[model samples]
Target chain A: MENKTEYKPFEVDQHLTAHGNYWAGKAGSRFFTSLRDKKKLLGSPCKACNKVFWPPRSVCTFCFGELKDMVEIGPLGTVETFTLVTYSEPIQPRTAPFIYAVIRLDGADTGMAHFLDEVEIGKVHIGMRVQPVFAKDRKGNILDIQYFKPL
Target chain B: MATKDKEWISIPMTVDVPYRFAAGGYMTKCLTELRDNGKIFAVECPKCKRVQLPPRVVCAECHVKNEKWVELPHEGTLMNFTIMYLPLTDPTTGKPHEPPFVYGSVRLDGATSVLDHMVEVEPDMDKVWVGMRCRLVLRPKEERIGDLSDIRYIEPLPGQKKPQTKSR
Candidate 1:
C-alpha cells in the first residue's frame, strides 16, 4: 500500500556519550580492591544466615544482615544456568554467540552471573565445571575475571 | 581476623547510548527538498495562514491540517543570538560545537516561524547583533544529505554594521 508521500523516509543516526563516576561501597570497595590488587575473588558472608554471596554484595538478601567481613572465593566453579546470546549488542563484552552463565563458585553459597568461554556453545550445559581467566590489566571491577573456561 | 587498612576506590566510566530517528511525512518532504533542489518548504495553515518551517502535519496554533506548502528564501533576519562559552555537544553528530561560537534564531523571509541555527560570525558582540540579515550556507550539491546538517551554517549578509549605542 502506498503511504502516498513525495519523498522516502529518512533515518537519522546519533549517539550519546554518558560520563559517570561510581563509588564502590564499604563491602564492594574491599571486594573489588581484592580482585585488582591480589587477583583474588572475594565473597561477602552473612553470619546470621551463613550465606556467602559471590560478586560480593553489601547486604544479605534473605536475612537482611550487614555483610561486613569478606572471604576469598573460587577461581573455579560450576555453571548452574546459562544462555547463548546469538545477537550482537553495543554494550556486550564480546562478539555474538557467546555464553553468559550463572556460576556457583566453590565454597560460596550463591550463584554469580558472568561470561563463559573456551568451549563449544552446543557442548556447554548446566553443572559444567569451569575456572576463571583473570585479565592482566584489571580495573577493580567484575570484569577483572574476564571469563570462565571449562576445566 | 581484624581487617587491614581500608582500601576504597571510585571508578569513572564512559558509556555510549546510540539513537536513531525517523523523519516522518512532513519533515521528510522538507529535508529531501533541501538536499535535492536546495529549496526550503514550510507548511501553511489554512485557518491561521501561518507558514511554519520544518513543515508540520498539523498547525500548532489553529489545530488544523497543514496542507499548503510554501517555498522559503534562504535569506533571513537574525531575531535573537547568543555567544556560547561552554562546549556543548551537537547531538546529531556526537561532537562538541566548540566554545565561544555564535548561534541564533533566524526568521526567514516570508516564513512566520524562526529556525535556530549556527551563525557563522565572530563571537564578539561588536561583530553581531539582533535583526542582522543572514543567508544560509549549505553543503555542496554532491555532499548534501537529507538532514538539517545539509545547511553548514548561517552567514551574515555583508555591508551591515552593528548600530552605535542608543543615547537614551
Candidate 2:
C-alpha cells in the first residue's frame, strides 16, 4: 500500500444535457395554447366526477372518465402554499431567494406551481389573492405570463 | 371532427438538471491521487489479484475485498478506438464536444481495466492504430480541478510511424 496521507472525500460536479420532444395530448395543448395566445386560464372538468384540473388533463383519475368540459378558469388565483428558495443554481428560472408558490386559480380545484414575484417574501402568505402578470412579448408558452403578483 | 388548426399543440422546452456526485471512499482515494499527485492508482483483489482501476470495494469475479493498492504508469497501449463524427454531448458540462475527433480506451500496464479518454490524433486509420503506445497528458497542477477532466487528452508517443501497407 502506498502512503495514505490525504483522506478527504470529494463530490464530482456535473450537469447533464438531455434533448427530447413532448407531445402534450389534446387537453394539454388547449391548456398551454390558451396561456400563450389568449393569456387566459383553461381547466378541464371531468364529466363523470366534476373534478376540474387546472393544468387540464384528458381524463379523470378518480372516475377514469373523459374530461370534455373546457372551462375558463382564472387570471386570478390564491396562493395555496409557497416556499422561499434561498439557493441559486445556473439552471433555475430566476435568481436565488425567490418565492415559488402553488396557486389555486379561481374556479379550479387544483393548484399549479410557478414563481411568485412583485411581492415581498415576508408579505406572502396562504390564501393570498394574486393575478397573473402577462408578458408583452408573448410566445405560445407558459412563460407568456412572467409571474403572479398581488391582486 | 375539428379542423387541423383546432388540434392541440406542443411547445419546445429544455429542462436542465444539475447534480453533484460524491466519489465514494475508494474512488475518492483514486481521483485525489490523480488530481494531486498525477499518479494512477488501482486496487488489487485479494483472492484473484486482478487490479481494477477506479478502485471498487469488492471484485466481481473473486467476490472478495480488494485491499492492495498499486500505482500504474502513465503510458499504456491503445486497446480500441473510434473516430467520432457526431458532436457528442459531454455530460460533465452539458455541452457538445466538437465532432470528428478520436477517442479510445487504453489498458494501462499491470491494470486489468482500461481508461477511456479523448485520443489526440488525426481521425485517420494510418495515424491511430490499436496497440499504439500513448501517454496521458494532464493539466498543470494549478489548473487541475480534481476531476477526470484533469486528463487533457492521450497523445501517441513521439517518433511512432504508420505501418507500411501493400497496394492491392
Candidate 3:
C-alpha cells in the first residue's frame, strides 16, 4: 500500500517574531546584583548536601532544603571544557570564532557557561587558569562580566 | 519570629529564537506549482471531495486521503476583511507588517477554501467591501522565492466598482 502511493515534495519558509519579559526571581537577583555592584561572584551552598551552585538556586535539588547561605566563589577559575563557535546568529552576544567555556570557579562545586577571551582558541585547554574581566559599566545582568581570560 | 524588611530586585532581558520548518509532500507540490508555473493547486478529499488549499495528505473532516489535485483560478471573491490598525508580526522575517492595511480572506473561483492575504485597497468602507472581486498579484518570477510571500497582495479587479450597500 505504501509503494502504490506517490509523493511530491514542497518547501515553505516562515519567519516569526516573538517578544517576552523575564524576571530573574529572588535568588537569581542576589547572584546577578553582587556581580554587578561589587564585581563579586556569589553561590548558594546547600546546608544538607553541602554542594555549591554557581547560578545560585533557592532550594537544594537533593534535600529540598532552603538555601540561604550565599558565599563568594571566584575571581579566578579553571576552564572545565570549551568549544570555539565559528558561526553567527542574531542572538549571539559576540562575533564568530569566539570561545565558550564551562568554568569551575575556585571554592565552588559547580560550573557555569560563559565566554573566554584574551587568548587563542588553540591555546585554551581544560584546567587552564582563567579570571573574570568585569565590564567598566555594570548592569545587574550576566554580561556584567565581559568574559573570562587566561590568568 | 522577628520580621525584617527584605529588598527585592528585578532585571530585564530579551531572548530571540529562530526556527525553520519543512513543508511536507503535499504542500511542497502545491507551493512549487504556484511558484514555477503560476498555477494554484489544491487537494481534493477522496471521500468528501472538499478541495483544500496548501494541500494536505488527509481530509480534516472525513479523515480520508486527499489524492485528487485541482487547479484554482487566480481571481476570487472577498468573503470577509478587516482593516488592521495594529502592527501585526510577519513570522517568517520577525518584522511587523505596517499597520492600517487592508487584509481579507478570499474564496477563489472553484475552490472550497479561502486564502487570507493582504488586500491592496484603501482602508475605507466605500472603497473596500465584502464580495469585492479580487485577483492574486504575484511577485515577479525573478523575485519569487517559493513561499506565501511570493503572492505580493490581492487587488480589486480593474474597472469593478463597489457593490451598492443595503440597509439592514
**Candidate topping lDDT:** 1
Off by over 4 Å in 3: A1-22, A76-103, A114-137, A143-151, B1-25, B93-96, B131-133, B139-143, B156-168
Which portions of model 2 miss their true places by more than 4 Å?
A1-4, A7-11, A17-23, A73-137, A142-151, B1-4, B7-18, B93-96, B157-168
Clashing pairs in 1: none
Question: In terms of TM-score, which candidate is strongest?
Answer: 1
Q: Tell me the lDDT of model 2 at B105.
A: 99
Per-model interface RMSD values are: 3.4, 2.8, 3.8
Distance from true position, residue A28, model 1, in Å?
Answer: 2.5
lDDT of 3 by residue, A1-151 (tens): 1224344565444444445656676688788878888999998899679699888889987899999879999989999999999999877888798999999989888899999999999899999999999999997888888999999
Q: What is the Å distance of residue B32 in model 2 from its true position?
A: 3.3
Docking quality class, candidate 2? acceptable
| Candidates 1 and 3 compared by lDDT, better number | 1
lDDT of 2 by residue, A41-110 (tens): 8998875676788888878878888777799999899999999999998778788989999999998899
For all the candidates, what are their Cα RMSDs to the real structure? 4.3, 4.6, 5.4
Better of 1 and 2 by DockQ: 1
lDDT score, residue A45, model 2? 86
- lDDT per residue for candidate 3 within B75-150, as digits (tens), equals 9999999999999977667678898999999999888899999999988888888999999999988888778788
Question: What are the per-residue Cα lDDT tens digits for candidate 2 across B1-168?
Answer: 656777567666676677889998888888888888898889999888888987898999978878888999989999999999999887676578898999999888888999999999999989999989999999998888777779999999999987776889
The DockQ values of the predictions, listed in order, are 0.53, 0.43, 0.31
TM-score of each: 0.79, 0.73, 0.72
Candidate 1 chain A weakest ten by summed lDDT: A1-10
Model with the higher lDDT, candidate 1 or 2: 1
Model 3 has an lDDT value of 0.85
